[model samples]
Target: MEREIFPWIGASRGTSILISKKKSFHYTDVIANNSSRYIIVSGIPQHRKITLINIYAPNSGQLVGDPILLGGDMNLVNNPLLDRSSRPLPADAALSTALDELQRLLRVTDVW
Candidate 1:
């Protein structure tokens, strides 16, 4: 059941945006009543490629930055409740931490 539903959902979301193991890629473009964004992922067989994500973060506005990325709609800006570890945290803590780290990282031009 999970396998069956997975493919259907993937297809519905236009996840087949690329092909080839040597240079495969996929992206989703979403447009809502007042917002738009993109999610992209690409790779090669033995090398790390690009994963460009565009998301609307609250208050801080549009943030355009580097390759090899993970981003999403962080609903709050300048919140300090997030954890800074490599491992996952509880949902609420993770959200706050992720936003904090993203904001902090964005400030450092050399880090991106």
Candidate 2:
């Protein structure tokens, strides 16, 4: 029997990033916390490098440099009236502030 291996990062419990065996790149750096996982890959066909982040935020974390893609459960809603149910819960003000700061610093836009 043979076993197939895939490149991955992060703890078993929290946030994680898994690279498919076919498209997995040569990663040079990794930063993982309770709420996020950062992986820096090299020799990305055309681009020199790209950073991939899997984040679950409002908790504290370190920021990564540019040419990156970030996605995860933000634990936030843009318009509670439209996005939430009948009993809408308010997002934590402090967390919202922090997330906003992160977005500004990263200069990235939400895709959806």
Which residue pairs show backbone clashes in model 2?
Answer: none
* Candidate 1 residue spans exceeding 4 A from truth: 1-72, 76-90, 108-112
Q: What is the C-alpha lDDT profile of model 2 across 32-104, one tens digit per residue?
A: 5433333333335234677665544333334344245666777775445665666556555555567768888
How well is each residue in 1-112 modelled by candidate 1, as lDDT tens digits?
1111012123323222234445433323323222222334333333545444334333333344533355344444333333333444346566666666866877622222
Error of 2 at 18 (Å): 22
- Which portions of model 2 miss their true places by more than 4 Å? 1-67, 92-94
Question: Alpha-carbon error at 34 in model 2, in Å?
Answer: 18
* TM-score for all models, in order of appearance: 0.26, 0.32
What clash pairs does model 1 have?
A: 82-96, 82-97
lDDT of 1: 0.38
lDDT by candidate, in order shown:
0.38, 0.53
